[model samples]
Target: MSGSGACEGLPGAVRVVAGVSGSPGSLTALRRAAREAARRGGELWPVIAWELPGGEFHAARSSVPPPLRERCEQLAREELLDVLDTMFGAAGPGVPLHALIARGRPGQALVQIADRDTDVLVLGAGHRGRLHRLLSPSVSHYCLTHATCPVLAVPPSPLEAHLATVCRRNSWHLRLDAGQLTEREKPRGRVRDA
Candidate 1:
């Protein structure tokens, strides 16, 4: 669908802004954002946010070399392109696509881009464990509280949840039962011959 016509929000055009990080959940969010944009007859804006090794405060304290900063931005840009290519391929999403590489926290960047009241901010509702949440702030929570526009936090896909269970099992050194494996595979029609 052509987004040539103006949308209600954002003065001229309605924007469906999504946060991408190359993660499976983020990929799901990206796909959902595209659909949202198409449904609203708006543009899709996928933003990848990045920061220096030690974040903005550290960079300000130390004289970060220009090359290093440039490299960080370049990597973020490449990741954004890779995600877009993976999702839509050469055909591109039906609506207009505008990719952004922002230099800040993911939540803050997304909230800033989707500033208008009518704009929609899409994010992955990451399935983070307690330790992970302690180490890093929850982007979805940040956006939900701070965003001026509506925030759509997509839940983790079933596959992602299954993968996380497998990882946890592996980390705990738990042996998988052969019968359980077959039982799980049977439902998916991938059972193996004995």
Candidate 2:
């Protein structure tokens, strides 16, 4: 959907635009955006941006089949709705929410939707390894630099980090120690540089 069209029926001039991708970090951002929207007496606009499997250059050369294109769009819409449903349930976020499924790069679509100066863009600043960063562009970094409105990059929750650590260990077939996990869970005091 067009950026302007997405806001056509939504209430409130001030918007808290959230970039959602069904990730735990993105969900955290969505929740924060909802709170911000409620506090500012504005609406929450959750946008999910998607592109073809092979990227734009590949699509340009091979003219993607119409069916495949439609399926991709459908998946994007489903993911957006699923994220909203998973986070807010039937009760909803207790704020006006306008969810959009846009076709393009995540950073660009989010920036475009949150075009107004009054709008606030919220994105997930998840932990990324060197390899991950090398493979994919950082959406949060892009938004922070490019968005005209204010940008809030929400860090992943502690639980998310723990889960990531567990997942990594599992993938690497490393032994998981309950004691180590507990130790990590304990809050740490600030340490001044020696």
lDDT values for all models: 0.84, 0.88
Q: Considering summed lDDT, which 10 consecutive residues are worst modelled in model 2?
A: 1-10
Root-mean-square deviation of candidate 2: 5.7
Q: lDDT per residue, candidate 2, 120-152, as tens digits?
A: 999999999999999999999999999999999
lDDT per residue as tens, model 1, 1-194: 11212223335678998899999999999999999999999989888889999999899999999999899988888888889899999999999877788888888878877889778999999789899999999999999999999999999898897677777888999986656543643365577889
Query: How many clashes would you count in candidate 2?
Result: 0
After best superposition, candidate 2 residue 123: deviation in angstroms? 0.5
Off by over 4 Å in 1: 1-11, 168-194
State the displacement of the C-alpha of residue 130, model 2, in Å, after optimal TM-score superposition. 1.7
